[model samples]
Target: MFVQPMWLVMLSWAVLFVGLASTAVVVVDQFVLGYRQPVKVMEMVWPVNALYLGPAAVLGYRKWGRPQSPRWLDRHGSPPRRSLNARTTIKACHCATHCTLGVLIATPVTYGFGLEMFGSTLWPEVVGDYVGAAAVGVAFRYYTEARTGGRRAWAVMRKFFMRDLLTVSVFEFALLGWLALMHFVFFHETLRPNGPVFWLIIQAGLIIGFFAAWPPTLLLTRRGVETELLSTPQ
Candidate 1:
């Protein structure tokens, strides 16, 4: 008996397809066509963000991301100057990508397996989201640490590990609140991940999460609490 309005369903699907298509274009550009990012972590970050940001992701990639690539630098001599907003945004995205991966993976798995805790899927969904984000976030740290190449590399990773945990907590807290509002108040639980409304919900969630997490990221960066994302590249 629960169903989205026909028009909402159609619009959601249209947005979903566009997001997927944008992701495809990013993948093709990064892997198939070799617009590879100079920094390793961003290779994953750009495409992951595209899943929700749609064509806006592509435009962000073109303006900020692509110019830092080896291909672009080789062609243009040096990357262009960018504002602090660009730097702050890209750094926040490093945390966001892992967070996004965790949520997207958890949502369907919890639903598909009928995974429940207490009375609903929310508990396991949050658990899975944090677990997945931690896993990937550690890997991102390792990649940067590996480039540092010293006995102190592990120490560097430990600092990054702690920083990421903090960053992800803020990111997830905001996103979880937004999603709870959507799930409990706005959309209800009528749609599965296979449907457009489901993806639409999460897409909206991540976009809002970006803004939610940005201020803390800016404060951390400006205060020198975190440095690797903007400073390191490979």
Candidate 2:
């Protein structure tokens, strides 16, 4: 019998609308206006980020993402080197894309099937999210390292996947905890993929997740993990 306050519900709708609009901006810029990234996966990355970050994601795409376009590289004749801060942001988002896809898939599957473990859907969702992220993370690593760099798959596993596992685990922590306490704890009955407030929680959680993961990603980048692979302009 609980109802979300009128202003809260309206705010949720407004926030979700902005996120959608932001995602559209990135899509139009990439697909329609042709500011496509040289790395095809980043086309997915940037827009997905916009789904949560709204105009801030668009701004990041404009600054860091746009310059990676082939057209820009051709005009400039070289890729401009980004600062450590910029590179760290890129690295976090690169890994975060995996987490995003994982959670998006997990949330619905758990909800739809009425799956639960340990008296909460969170446990199963966590498993699905982790497995999905690792699967995609390994695939991305294979593409970037084993296939592109010509390293052996095992070597790539040792070098990339291990580090990525740590990064993504840290990345997922805050968002997962947030959902557990704020969304699932109070509104468990109401929040679903079909609900706007669900996405509102997701949106806010991802922003928190971004901040949570940033520090470790920056440390890893400074230590020269995934540096060359992430640095490729093409």
Compare the candidates by TM-score and give the number of the best one: 1
Per-residue CA lDDT of model 2 for 82-134, tens digit only, reads 99999999888877788888888888898899998978777888788878777
True-vs-predicted CA distance for residue 206, candidate 1, Å: 0.5
Per-candidate local distance difference test: 0.79, 0.79
How many residue pairs clash in each candidate at the backbone level? 0, 0
Cα RMSD for candidates in order? 2.3, 2.2
Q: In model 1, where do residues sit more than 4 Å from their true spots?
A: 150-157, 230-234
Model 2 quality (TM-score): 0.89
lDDT of 2 at 29: 89
Which pairs of residues collide in model 1?
A: none
